[model samples]
Target: MDTHITGRTAADIADSVRSLLERGVLEPGDALPPVRTLADRLGVNRNTAVAAYRQLTQAGIAVSRGRAGTRIVDRAPVPQEGFAAGSVLRDVGTGNPDAALIPDPSRALADVVGRPVLYGEPVIDRELEQWALEWLGADLAPRDIRVTVTSGAVDAVERLLAQALTRDDAVALENPCFLSAIHTVRLGGYRAVPVPVDEQGMTPAGLRAALDDGVRAVVCTPRAQNPTGASLTAERAAELRAVLADHPYVLVIEDDHFSMLSHAPAQSLIGAHHRRWALVRSVSKFLGPDMCLAVTATDPYTADRLAMRLSPGTTWVSHLLQRLAFSLITDPEVREGITRAGAHYAERNDSFAARLRAYGLPCTPGDGLNVWLALPAPARAVAEQLMRRGWLPRTGEEFAVDGLPGSAHLRLTVHELDDTDAERLAADIAEAVRAVSRSGSGMIDR
Candidate 1:
């Protein structure tokens, strides 16, 4: 079948490609014609064909591989954190907090429903704003800051990037980045400049290289960085800030997703003198994912821009939800529960890491819901062996940025596992590694 893409103008050409995709004539991985070939065939200028390809790329309907040519994006759904649907295997890869650890919102719901919020009223609930101000101000003091309520950390990041960046603008992202962050960047049609992350968080040199490459914005995870669970140390934070001291205008967004649930103290990359920045703290980790409320603290200018997108009467966050979150977070009993939850995650993750280490795997219990287990063989090979043993784990390659080499690690969420299961998993992981080694299939660099 001759898959036809027929049009003269750029918009028309792009629309034709979309039509072909819709009709199943142009499948994913199918390459569009070279600009010159398409132009000659359609009797249009070469630039017109280029522009059409660019439009498709920006819409995420296609991807450009330079000399290799542009091809359709798969459009398959990206894997998200949480349970895998209908899986019979024991899932140790679900990046979810223990449901029992989340604070009960039943008691707080009654106190939060005092009054109905109407249009033209302040978007943020007054009580929530006050509480959020104090909470964020403690970390980002002396600098003028304003609070904006977003649906969640992902929403805040998307909005923040939209407000500060235009399509095709470059943004710095961690090498083994969070899934949502990667999706957000790609969907926004922005270029993601990879910054390598080490044990102490994003390396200063990597940040410098990204800044040198002209990234307009940088998204950082201050604590409990997803996937690897790496947190920035005080010294490393200072070094990163120093590197950014020169380029103070680049918008810096810190997504502190595991805020109340993180055992590590927050180490900020946003310096006092920085011109534009945002610190986003979501309540989902401690209050439950369904809460869907995140408090973003940012410079006045950034706050103003974000507010425009979240303007009252149209896109504002629900005042009732904000009030409920504030009520639960400030309650004494809820506070204790959050603290205990943090401890429980830390203890369980540590115990699992110790067991993996005893089995000869170089696993570390980072300050998050998962353990990053370094494998001597390929992570996929080990994961395959694990699956054969009725276990499912997330491979580190899934979190790695595009253009980077495949990873030799696995991110396992073992915090919910009891001692018996934990031990079994450890033993299974050891057996998996040994099986891979004996097969002599996937030996690669660490």
Candidate 2:
């Protein structure tokens, strides 16, 4: 009998598997012995082997496939938001704001210089905090809230989850979720319970299902959701809030990342009476990614816990950055420029969507910096064809939580593309879809 996975206790066996993984003895996708077989071999209860596999799954080291048994998960780095480094193709997949649209900080920076902020002082800049309070208070009105500053939306979410959840906790995320959110949940060892999103935003049925599954935290993008650009309608938001009202203790995080840039009106899923909720607005979208700052408004209890993690003399955001962000955002000229920028993004995306529709492809002018184009063929195959035609696009599969096959959508960032480039890219996508359909390599979902 092979004694490779020899251990009597669940933790012991899980540790042994990790050791084997570290030594490259058990490669990714390699199936482990059946629980019963392993238990018999190790002279332990079958439940012990099951528990071992559960531990590995929770740690993201392995995956359980029921009757097919468990296997080591491939830990390759997931794709993130940015330009593809060194790619020669006309990259339309990059989910970036227009450089021309970002407000100029040169004048703001010159005036932002102030006294050096010493340790043990307040982490948040007083001016920035006052501005953020009015800003966040406008939307999250009637509910008493406390504000906390973080490096960015992603940073705020990580800290929020860390304060509220532990390992193996379940977090409800949108099905075609934000890339950063997916990565954060996985890296934190939280099981992501996917909630399906429709044109109006997160479905009430999906939210209910996730809550029923015992998710401890729910992360939602109320407006301009990433990848799909699905904004929550007021009716949908009301429905979701009603669903969430029962679970008042569950931590709800609304990442309104596209606060200034979104063409859609703001809608929220956090109920007025909910006890634990947060609204995170980041300036990275309109102010440029270099400005790493996000203002978060949360219930007082969550705020207290988050403050401890972001205490003075530790991980507090830099006062200089806060001052600079404040100056730029509050400047009347900069605010006017930001409004124009938002309009620019909306117009470009709308034009591209119209171009795709002209080519017989279905696409909606969703709110965001990118257009979620639906194709008649598999997104991966079409993406490959587009690459050959001098274009780079992000397949919807890259954004899917479950990595389901036959994804027929591509997220294209065409706002920066000129009229000629936009038309050419749209024509190329139509051609690629036709070619892939003719090849019949995979079944098309749509």
Candidate 3:
């Protein structure tokens, strides 16, 4: 298939082919037609075709033989590790929510102890599942919602997609996707189609294109979109709903991973249509990630499919854990703690963004438990430099879909920084960005 690169560069044309192969559109050992035929088919010059082929060959994706024609070299290159071992920079790049902010599971778990469901017991805890449905249904309102709890939201999404898709089936996802989404798609052996996002969230054009390309599932972040805090606006969510109406049967999974941590009003893409869908709001961010629980709401049909996967041999989610989550959510003290944490994250991140701007680094701030900032150069070099300064920050590269590379950005857990620590760390990051840009070097300034 000729990748449509009508308005794209010659190299972009090549990249499209690479992207296609990465998505399994081009199978291993599959023969590509002669360069001339490809150029004619794609409306590109023969020289452009030659360059594109050479580019693919150098990427270890395709190989050339005198008369055998170019063939796909099966297999993917190992991904380079982006984060330094135990090098989480103190100032920024800690993807975790503030430890102090997590509702003390101690107090919440104090009340929970239930009789374990023994052999021959139903796989799901009926009361817990019913309560979970009520809690998860809080935002989206009544639909064909059914509750299916798994180890966590990641586990939930993985099982949900597996029940619906096959290996190499196209799964639409936001570009610069959540880390768990990337891992889930990879583990399931599914192809990810990148849908571009902006301040208002997933672009309509990108989504329409993905649908046209025959995607089987979509994984979207409604609010507190990781890496960038951009969320779906009310207008934008309505637009997506309108756009998705025609394709209701496509499984749409929305991950509200940072639920209740931001003051921003929730807007949903899944709310638009009544088709195969699941909206997962995990307690990881607002509640502690260690809770190991996620509230998943899916259509009745999809829930039935997931129930089979949750049956015996799985043993189901622990009754104790579910009761703990239920107790915590319903607790007045815990709810107050959540509100306090949301305010703390908002204020601290805003302050950090202010400091960055003071140093001439601009950023688009939004509602997340953390802040996203653009580095003067690629984020990796800046991150390495920070490590030498005794700080660890997460770069944008780690959060993108396989064929798409995230840009010069960093995600910082500003809420964890004290006032003095915040100022010093900001200065250190600024200096590091400048140093890497000047030397074009990977070594951090000692």
Candidate 4:
């Protein structure tokens, strides 16, 4: 059946499709008529229909499959990491740091109290700003960098993108991108150009292709990339820097979200000669998610634009939150706790991967809070079986982009699991993989 969208302009046509989607008339995977066909039916220029489809694609509501027509998006390109609602199964997909591992902010609360921050004051806490400048500056190549504070990594990313790009501007993102970055690019009406990532982080060939495609900005996770836990090697970082040198004006944003907690050293993307770049670090993984604080160090031009939105008395992050994070990060005891927590996460994930390998499912333990387990069967099938066995696992499909095939990998978090729990879960996962292999397509209910 042909999808009927009654409108001429791009906005009108996009709105019609959006309404049909909301009403469930345009179901996921349902194909739209060819652009030319739609233009003829609507008695408008073919370019108008094309423009409308482009809008839908940018908004992450529809996808163009080249020879195949455009279709409504089945679900978000990247799903959030956490327990699914109404699920009673033990969750191994929530990308959460162990609560016990997070340093208690209450102990730091007393230290955070001081003079109340008045109106028109500097947006960032002075002490925090100075600390961040020193911390971020030490790693960056010689450059005139300025610092800006935002609510968290997500906030920093959103502000950076807004400052650097406009509607439909192409931005290169890692293929298995972070969910928030996917959401930010989609909601901002910007085009996301996917660059493939591997064990060594963003590949040189993929990044070169994206640069050739005229992407205005690039968002990279330098270490402990979400879902995949890939980190850039020194060699790969050099290659990427070389490729980016020709495109000096392109804004490169590195999200070092796992900084203190990451076992990997920072392999930076911003070379000394690159014209525009930002490095954002957040305390969410170490201090606590509730801390809601991140510091962004960037080139002066980007900082000026970011400051427009972060001006005092308007969108500035609360100094109280900033102080709390600063205190937690600086306390010697809290620092030790964070260091131990980091080691604990790495060890737990490594142990889980080793167990899975011994069970005949070879997997790698990456630096992030989770382990990516590769199964012999499709991850969704294995995940469904795991759910039946009272474990909820997140399939890699949620993190893939660009019409890429669903991965046989599962992103699992085991930082909070005990020895017994880890062993049991590994055994169940192996069984689930075997079951899926035996049953094939019949095992999973659509």
Candidate 5:
């Protein structure tokens, strides 16, 4: 392992350490040499070794003991799936929408121009905004509709929080919340109040609790919430609205990421009543992946405040891509494509969940792009076993909110599993639970 520690910089040192652990040269609890001695031996500054140590710590490949040196930590294995295109049965994780939902853009971009716009180019194309306005609907008018585009729903969330919050401010969010929303709040240096979300969107009790806590802002997903896919019901929405009515001026941000492709209609926290709110809807779901554009409708006053952070010199969204999105959404053929894709995703996910139930593995299959599964053991260990069987499953740990205990469940994207493979995965998951379900592993507490 020392033979590979030849470079004189921080990254080189980190790579050498990583390579050692990867090759099993340093097993768990084996201490690295003293920083000064390692620095001298590698012929580099002490800072380089320090930086390398930090990198390993972040990656969970190693841990430090202050004055003591570093040692390796156990890591779960990573699986390798083949890189094949045009297969809908291989995509997993929170961030991906169903591939079938993506608009076929080969024809749209085929004839489109390729010039990247220069400075002073319009931040938003006038024609595109007009089309987007119609797309969002006419009921959202009379109050104010300000359309601002961003990379995606997550991008819009970050910018909205940045403008509304100072570091360490409190923000309300859904519990077992979408990971991007949780991460965005934490990254902005804000404390998160996890309001519970049930069949009814944010519960009335949860809303009241959060408001009583004096949160600076609220991030909500009123429709087709990512992990659970439970769209807020009308009765629940009304109760939540009543709870929020007292704090009319708090910045209310709603992320309805499944804009056009959702099987159900959109619900809103920023609907007709609110005075200070933003309804952020992104096109990444129906449009092709990597297409980054979002339409934000806000109350006029809030729109002006948000605009201050979105002026020409700073963070305005792109214009050319906006036009391309406009061209696709307005076209009739692309609209049908989205409808077809939504049905396909629902059918596939429902089938997988039904099969899981048939196999005695209880789970929930709801409206979004994925399935939520409740396992009999810790999700992390089960996911590791799934990988060894050629399935790459994501655990719910990353998306758990502050108040919630880490789950024994996993959020599986059934889009990646075909009929045959779904059956096999279900069987493998059952075996994995039996193999790793050690009673005192702290899995229950986790």
Candidate 6:
């Protein structure tokens, strides 16, 4: 293992460490030299070494031990699934929307370019705000709701948490949560209190327990929750609202990431009378990830604080991108395309899940772009077997927030696959499960 660390600047040193990590040159539990020793070796001031260490800690790449020194964290880094470069295996693990379903922005771009915004201009595009409010208002009960635009859902969540909660404050997050949300909570230094989510979304008992634990904020996905593709039923949403009623002051954040694509209706957890709340609708699913625009409907107080952080000339989302998103959403042809795309995703996911069940592996197709397939064997073993069979799938452990061994499950994005590919994946999945079910390693009953 390469354990050497050398750089004149803090950022340089941090980048070097991250590169080594990505290349697997330095594994977890490896120790770095003392700051004084590293500073001398790198020919930099002692403060530079300290800053580099601090940067690494903030990024969750390394942990500091009081008298012992700094070392790579023993835990596996959060899993991020990117395109499998140079791999001939059929990839079913990429957590992404179907590329063909995304509406082309070329037509919308013509209408998006008229205005050039200047400093001190309105942070949000006027037309976009009006349209967003109209769409959100139909679902939300009458109230004084404020709106803020952010680059993306993760960006909005990070800013919202920073504005409302202090470091180490407890924030309730769904168990087997969205990967980005998990990263946001961890990187923000907020304590994550896991609330179990079933088919109907976050369980009432789980929310009650988290509230009892004194979580200052609650993050929920009202529809098409990532990984599991779970949506909140109206009854379950009401139950959660009742639980949250006593604690109205807690900041409730609802990430409706699949707003346009969800086959389900919006079952909100933020009651009309809730004090501080935000409902984020990211357009990435419909428009494309490159759009990077999300409209946030928030309570006045939270919006005000978020505005403080996103002040003009600093953190405001670009108006050009906002207008481009708005143009696409308002276009009739694009709306029709989005509607067709939603149905296509639902059909594909359901079809894939049905095939899995037919093969004797239990699986359910939920509201999102992915299907959650519960396996009889450990997800790791099954995934390994599938990889050997020329497929890549994500294990449920990647989405677990509690750091415990996860239930046996695989989160697969098979909605983009054709009938033959989907069937092949299902048959392979069943075979993999049977091959590993008796191995007796990391098996957890759902």
Regions of model 5 farther than 4 Å from truth? 1-95, 98-101, 110-122, 138-142, 312-315, 403-405, 436-446
Show the colliding residue pairs in model 3: 88-392, 89-391, 89-392, 93-394
Query: Model 3, range 144-170, lDDT digits (tens) per residue?
Result: 678778888888899889899876678
TM-scores, one per candidate: 0.94, 0.92, 0.78, 0.87, 0.75, 0.84
- What digit string (tens of lDDT, one per residue) describes model 6 on residues 1-446? 32456567999999988888878888888898888888888888999999998998877788777699888876646867556567788888887888988988887777778757887778888999999998877777689988899989888999999998866578999998998899888777777999998898999999999999999999999999887889999899899999999998999999999999888988899887899999999998999888888899998899899998787435678888888888888889999999999999999988998998898777778998888987767888899999999998888988999867645889898887899988898899888887786676766565
Top candidate, metric lDDT: 2
Best by TM-score: 1
What are the lDDT scores of the predictions, listed in order?
0.88, 0.89, 0.78, 0.86, 0.73, 0.86
**Which residue pairs clash in candidate 5?**
none
Worst 10 contiguous positions by lDDT, candidate 5: 75-84
Candidate 1, run of 10 with poorest lDDT: 398-407
Q: Report the Cα lDDT for candidate 1.
A: 0.88
Off by over 4 Å in 4: 1-78, 312-314, 403-405, 440-446
Candidate 6 Cα outliers beyond 4 Å, as residue runs: 1-76, 438-446
lDDT of 5 by residue, 136-235 (tens): 6553535657777777788778877877777656799987788777766655557789887775567878888989998979888877786778787767
In lDDT terms, how accurate is model 4? 0.86
lDDT (10s digit) by residue, model 1, range 1-446 = 12388887999999999999999999987888888888888899999999999999878788887898888876656667888899999999989989999877888888888767786788888888998899998987478889999899999999999999877789999988898999898778788998999899999999999999999999999898888889999999999999999998999999999988888888899998999999999988888889998999999999999988776434788888888888888889999999999999999999998898888887777898888888888888999999999999999888876734457889999888999999999999999989989999968756
Q: Which 10 consecutive positions of candidate 3 have the poorest summed lDDT? A: 76-85
Query: What RMSD does each model have against the real structure?
Result: 2.1, 2.4, 9.5, 4.0, 8.9, 6.1
Q: Which residue pairs clash in candidate 4?
A: none
